[model samples]
Target: MMVVSTMTSPDTVLDFAHAVALGLSDRPRWLPSRFLYDERGSELFEQICELPEYYLTRAEAAILRRVAPVLRRKTGPVTLVELGSGSSVKTDLLLAAYAEEGASVRYVPVDVSASILRTAAERIEETFPSVNVSGLHGEFEQALPLLEDYGPVMLLFLGSSIGNFNQAESLAFWRRVAAALPRGGWVLLGVDLAKPAAVLEAAYNDAAGVTAAFTRNLFARMNRELGAGLDLAAIGHEARWNPEWQRIEIGARFHRRQTLHVEPLGRRFTIEPGELVMTEISRKYSLPNLTEYLRCFGLATAHTATDDQRRFAVLLLQKGE
Candidate 1:
């Protein structure tokens, strides 16, 4: 049985406006990275995963293919809950492993996009008819609490999406997940490890410019949904690697001083020439650093698998008894 739950809180629009207002008003303006995943933006991101310079997805998928059976065996029979399960493309490997392991597999994929979640859920049912599938259409923070109701679940945070959250935020999220899990529950975390600066930079600023389009689509989304008069041409995409932070920052730089009235907030803010409004941050981590991070949340790493290039890793973690 495939069940679909929709979460369209009335405050979502106001929530977006308030978040945008606060972020834009701050010194060194920023737009919440979550805002970058509007419909068109999601489609562009799917393209980005296929780019030659974007090796994170491919590397992580390779590792998952090798470790899927192992993870299935370790977790035994449990529901698989995935956050930000966009398309659930690479998830097939694990789903197959679970089914083959004779586990009573049930998949609960949570994502903010209703259409995407529905499509992915349908495809999953078609592919693994024996497995019960459900789609939770809501933000991770909103949908995660429901995991407790599902019982013995193996949580998945794939695609290196956790990189968007800084250390503090990531730890806080892990705490929430940790609280929801029962004893012996497991979490599969995907992370992109720090690499040469050049490799990191190229991944975000790909030569084919799909990544640029992905960033620019945020401006288009604001103009269309928020009624913001943003001139898309006046801003350009930029991706930079901060060696000190071991993170890649993706943002848009204002070409010139410009002011635009935002109908959503009934306000205008002058954007200075050369000013940058950061859109996303992809933080890379080392094994030791990640281990320490997991420990802070009272979780321990159970196993880790990486591709030959060592560019990405998938860590299987469990809460300490």
Candidate 2:
């Protein structure tokens, strides 16, 4: 009769509350990416992956497919931790490789959804019966300490999740992830590279409008969790790529605009016309940036894989020798 809650921390509620206040407080109210998945958001994202224009999912899968052999060679008792690992399709390759090599892997997936985590844990356990499939339902930033629970971890921040942070934020996050690990630890991250305007733009602003729905679901999530009376119908999704910052920005725009308060955190704000809450930032990286990033964190780059167009890159980092 152990009734364990799926979400591990109270920080998630705080993060969600804070994101809502920031997004709706001032004009041009925006929604945070953390609020995107409320069952509906996760389903929307899964659909997004199937869309013809959203190539990131399929492209990244191909790279992981090619590297299955190299990954299988890694030593056992490996701890595989994924940050923002919802709809983590590429993990199949890793788990299969682990079995073939007689390796027992530990999968630690951290996200901000109880329902998503509950379902994910069930599916992952079914797939990798031998491997210990534990999960932490919290933000990646806060889950650093939890990494200790999965010793000698090979941290994965795949699916262009790193792009969700700004350059400075990315560096700080990297340092935090590196510090959490003992020497000889390894990290594998997927990064979307700067590419042609049309290709990059199309990826985020898909024709089927799945990304838009995914963005708006943030408000729907708040309505459910915080008792905020949000009209999901009044919000729409928009994605913009800033060439200056080399990032993909997603946000929800209030339809007619209005003022709403999230009382749990005790904040009130006005939403403006066509303004964005700035949910996620997908920062495009070049090889130079990736190299400098790992070096600063005391990690040495061991190998890298790139897509056919070199439009995306996956780099593996090892603790300094």
Candidate 3:
């Protein structure tokens, strides 16, 4: 198992502190969702994936299972680079398909969490001895520029993670990705299609409460890492669909007035009752619009696959000359 450390622990901590301080000071208090994926948060998210109401994982996996072989044939021999690859459970389908085709592939799983990235790299190496695994430990932005050194590669941005970015951010992000990729490189993007508000709401607010636990884990992370004395019990999980934005906003709603003190920043933030501090946003998209959007970034759609119900889609895109 090979893991490359692109970011040092002190650098990561500083980045986190800056993001937290800036976000908390915003007019509408917010937190960078990326920080929610510490070791514990990652585990909670895996549990949330199994909830029946959370259909995203099942839908994307089904599509990948069906299309992986086709993708292998189309892309020829190329390394698989997955952004924000957590556990990489769904990625096994793609790796297995390549193996069956008698193709020796290299996989690069990039993530912010070191522990999860290391574990995933070891597991993949053990399970698929023929495939080489190189784990990159850092944010997507940090790893994107390094893709040029990897030669021919297929960038996998699965699980609708792009939804975390708003329009401007997404456009900027894809532009950077397109600039980073070698000509003719590929990107397999997973997106959740726009759906009814009720369905979107239920997906995030699962009956099993796993999703809630996963969101609430952010507080635990803040308290432990940032030295922020956050009262986890004082905030409740909230998920609501914003039709105007075509996104589901997940936030922590304070039950009562509370003050949080961060030892690292030596700062204090106060929250009033019912105040919602946005943690994440899952933006749904229309397939047609998304296809056009990618074109602006020099990414042309090569193939598209979706679940039977059209709840989710995994598009195979190529960076053009």
- Which is the leading candidate under lDDT? 3
Estimate, for each residue in 1-321, the C-alpha lDDT of model 3 and write its tens digit: 455565545236667778888888997889889888988888888888888999999999999999998998899888899999999999999999887745687899989877788888888888888888888888888888889988899999999999999888887899889889999999999999999999999999999888788888888877877787777889899999999999999999999888876667788888899899899999999999999989988899999999999999999999996
> What would the per-residue lDDT of candidate 1 be over residues 1-321, giving only the tens digit for each residue?
789888666227667787778889998888888878777777888899999999999998999999998997787778999999998999998999998845568899988767677888999898887789888888887776787888888889999999999777787788887787776778899999999999999999999999999998988877776787888999899999998888999999999887755667787788988999999999999999889978887788999888998989999998777
Leading candidate by TM-score: 3
How do all the candidates rank in terms of lDDT, highest first? 3, 1, 2
Candidate 3 steric clashes: 0
The stretch of ten residues in a row with the least summed lDDT in candidate 2 is 1-10
Question: Model 1 segments beyond 4 Å from truth?
Answer: 8-11, 101-103
Candidate 1 at residue 251, lDDT? Answer: 96
Kindly indicate the candidate among 2 and 3 with the higher lDDT. Answer: 3
| TM-scores for every predicted model | 0.96, 0.89, 0.97
Every candidate's CA RMSD: 1.5, 2.7, 1.4
**Residue 247 miss distance in model 1 (angstroms):** 0.7
Go through the candidates in order and give the clash count of each. 0, 7, 0
Q: lDDT (0-100) at residue 82 of candidate 1?
A: 94
* Candidate 2 residue-pair clash tally: 7
In terms of lDDT, model 1 sits at: 0.86
TM-score of 2: 0.89
